[model samples]
Target: MPLKLYKRGKVWWISGTVHGQAVRESTRTHDKEVAEAIRVKKEAGLVSDHVFGPKATRTFAQAVESYLKAGGDARFIGGLDDGLLCHFYDTPLKDIQQNDLDDAARKLYPTAQPETRNRQCYTPFVAVWNHAVKNGWADVRQWSRPKKPKGTNVVRITKRRAGTFPVEYEHAARFIAAMSPGPAMLMTTLFYTGMRPIELFALEAGEVNVTGRWISLYKTKTGEPRGIPMHEFLVPIFTSLLKRPGLDKEPRLFRTPRGEPYEQIATDEEGRGGGGLKSAINGARRRSGIKDIAPYTGRHSCSTGLVVAGVHPHIKDQILGHAADDMSRHYTHVPQAPLIEAINKLPVPDAWHALPWLEDPLAWSGRLAEGTGRRTDLEKRREA
Candidate 1:
């Protein structure tokens, strides 16, 4: 039987059988003409699916829905779907070719850097397409991604580097000293542990073991659980912060002055995920006169420091949670001595000792702590 349109209250609905499959759904419109059009399209699609198989009828939008239902990370995929949907919404999954993807990338991000285009466009597209492939909705195919120009090692000195800027320990100490206790401790932890900002924001008080001198991260960007050895310099800082009166019952280790968890994660329209510390970090950078520094600077600085200090590549990779071995990841009893030794090699500048938070972290607890007294000499001079 052909699908027939009927009125259910004020809304139009369709019910009947097409291609021997039962179909009953709301057209979700009050207009009879629109409802009739929907019913016809539905009947046609059913007939095509029955004749050509599901792959021929399935759309990219449908595959995206299935991918999301299967627990795909929606941060980037959700935010960036408008352009993708505009290009491929009604297009059959089987009909989407490599050239179509390439055209989509160019049309979506005409002026974006190659890296940005790859990250925002190609990565998410491949992820959804691969998910469809796994479910037998599409054939397996590799989509080409934009690549950076090959390095020739000809000393090309650019004012600004392409990636995360690595701040020196001296500048880092100055920057941390300029902020209040809450943000200062957060930045310090990032530098020492080399953990991603998202991971630090999600850190629970229970995961931090001061006595063991190791912080356990159950969730990471890579979806692997691993441990980070706390630097000796961080020992007193964490010890002080953890011993605060009500922290024993608190779920999150890091919190704002108002005693709320840091906003953890925020997604921009471009589908980038940033930590909640943007304002605090910007304020600190301005005060310290370090225009180039960002929250990710601490992570980059940690990696640079490890390399400069002659830490082994394997040990550095493990500490930075980058492509670690299966044994190191699975074996809970793996020794922490190597990680600890590598982390401790990161330099601690003498200028950090002068920061009041280094001695008494709780002193800068309130909103008032961000006053003139906490400002660096450069900040003070600007005010004067």
Candidate 2:
């Protein structure tokens, strides 16, 4: 039977069989002429699919749906799809080409930089197209991406910078002292281990081996397990934090003042994750009079400190979890002694020694107690 349209209340509904398949859907209009047009288009699409197979009718929207359903990362893809769907809703996947992508990029982000166009538009489009190719809905074709003008440097000036910055120990110490205990400890760990913010946020209590003085990171930005040696300064801090009451039941090693785990990690265009310590760090920045200190500053400081201390580049790479060029990284029995020695060489300035937490690692415990309505041994001692 051919497709037929009938009025269901004020709206026209489509119901019929086309090419051995049943179709029943709303034309979603009160105008009979508009409904008839939609019904005709739908019938023609069904006939084309039956004659040429489903690939001839597959749309970019359909490819995106399949890609996401197959567990593709939707962090940026979902947002990119909003504009892309408007342009390619009914357009078949086979019809999209490199020129169409270039046009779409220009239309979507007229003033955006080449890097921004590449990340925000071309990246997601190519990803969806590649997924479609894998599913045999579209042919494989290399899409040209927008590139920055050659021989010209583009400096984007924003209030908050995204990547790492140089931070000295004295400045970092002052910043850490200005923060509340939880964030102070968290920042201190970041400075010592140079771990990514996302990796630290996802750290489990079980992953920290204070006895062995090593932090085992099972998931990293590089998708490989990393072992970071605990700095001597951090050994006492983690030892104290891990020994706190009820920590045995808590999976996350770090928490906010309210004793809840950090929020989910979010990645920016650069693919770096900072998780959730924004408010605390911002408050500390105001108090410390350090306007440039961000969560990633510590990681940069650690690397610089290691370099200034004259540690070898290879050992520094090992400590910082940078991809190594040598075969030593592939061996399971690689020695941690060199990495440990390299990390310890990071100098602790006098400013760090003056911080109160160094004397009593649990000093932050008082603040946690205030939030949780529980008193720590230090608070009880003070009362006594």
Candidate 3:
């Protein structure tokens, strides 16, 4: 129930009550001044808890659920914390050790598909445990350091796919142009502006500023409200889509053909539980002859496009609601004029035009509509 501060080797240490039990951690600062400051902060946190009555005892699992629930609404990628928290929830926080974690990781490979298991389970384990230690809920010294199995070919096969999707803007434009009012605008907005799919989908009509050429996004991955300038190409598209004769009634910017908002697409019906953005991206990719594209790819495409066109990495990060001030990345924000000009300079190649498949509306509808299969008729004609 008491908090203590001391020095071990060169590192400053802080230890105190976590759910009325002792928990301790190194501040990881070798500098005496910095360590003292951190120790002060730790003591202050403990004092705050003492005055506030411990702010409800949250287990590792409970914290993860809370983090995800609050974070899920954010427009940014919620990192590895969610899954790790889930694993902690499934396994006892105190019982998990480095060896056990390694064993769990090894089991993921060969037995349960290691790569899938590592991403789905292992990485998150490291993250949430780290979270637990940082938040003073557990002693970092007690957690076991799970070692990588020697001679195990930890081939990181799931490497990030390299090279930007250069043709995304053009393909996006064509698909947007081809799309019946509702989806066209949604896709166009994603293509031009680098807003996360959730951020865009989460948009209410009021957040959009057609006259001012910017959109205000309240909930972002960084937990900060950011305003990004609208792409000039998108202004007309949004204005038309927003005020389109029959479309103005819906409060949301995008909806299904049947007039369902993107969020409400989940009707709890069979085979259509919560595809949301996935369904739309698959539909667009099938027609565009672009294989393996996901809805988030639009965001990636826009981000990379900006990067390629000489927009500052920090600005793109800011626009996408990324933590641009992450000193580790050493990024500098591109000024507004240069950033806008750079974005305008993106090369949106007409790659989809080369593929004749997307010309038909039936091919573009998510999951082939009936009587839309060209191969079936071709086989019949050949037989005849």
Evaluated with TM-score, which candidate comes out highest?
1
User: Candidate 1 on 1-384: residue-level lDDT in tens?
Assistant: 999988999999999998789998999999999999999988998898899988888998888888777655555454334667667888999888889988988988898877778877888888888888877788888678887777786454546631266878997888777776687788788888888877887888777887878888875655567888889988887777676667666667777655677766733322135455666766766667766666677788899999999998888888888855677777433448878888999988887767665666654443323453454433443356
Task: For candidate 3, list the clashing residue pairs, or say none.
Answer: 84-124, 98-146, 109-114
Residues 218-312 of candidate 3: C-alpha lDDT, one tens digit per residue:
65533446666677666655665565334445556655544556763221111122336446444555655555344455677888788777777
Query: What ranking emerges by TM-score with the best candidate at the front?
Result: 1, 2, 3
The Cα local distance difference test for each model comes to: 0.75, 0.73, 0.53
Which of the two candidates, 1 or 2, achieves a greater TM-score against the reference? 1
Local distance difference test, candidate 1: 0.75
lDDT of 2 by residue, 268-351 (tens): 423254465777776676666777767777778888899998999877877778854346445313337777788888778787
| Residue 265 C-alpha lDDT in model 1 | 78
Q: Which of 1 and 3 is ahead in lDDT?
A: 1
Better of 2 and 3 by lDDT: 2
Once fitted onto the true fold, the runs of candidate 3 whose alpha carbons sit more than 4 angstroms away are 1-57, 68-86, 90-119, 122-168, 171-180, 221-223, 244-250, 264-279, 285-288, 324-339, 348-384
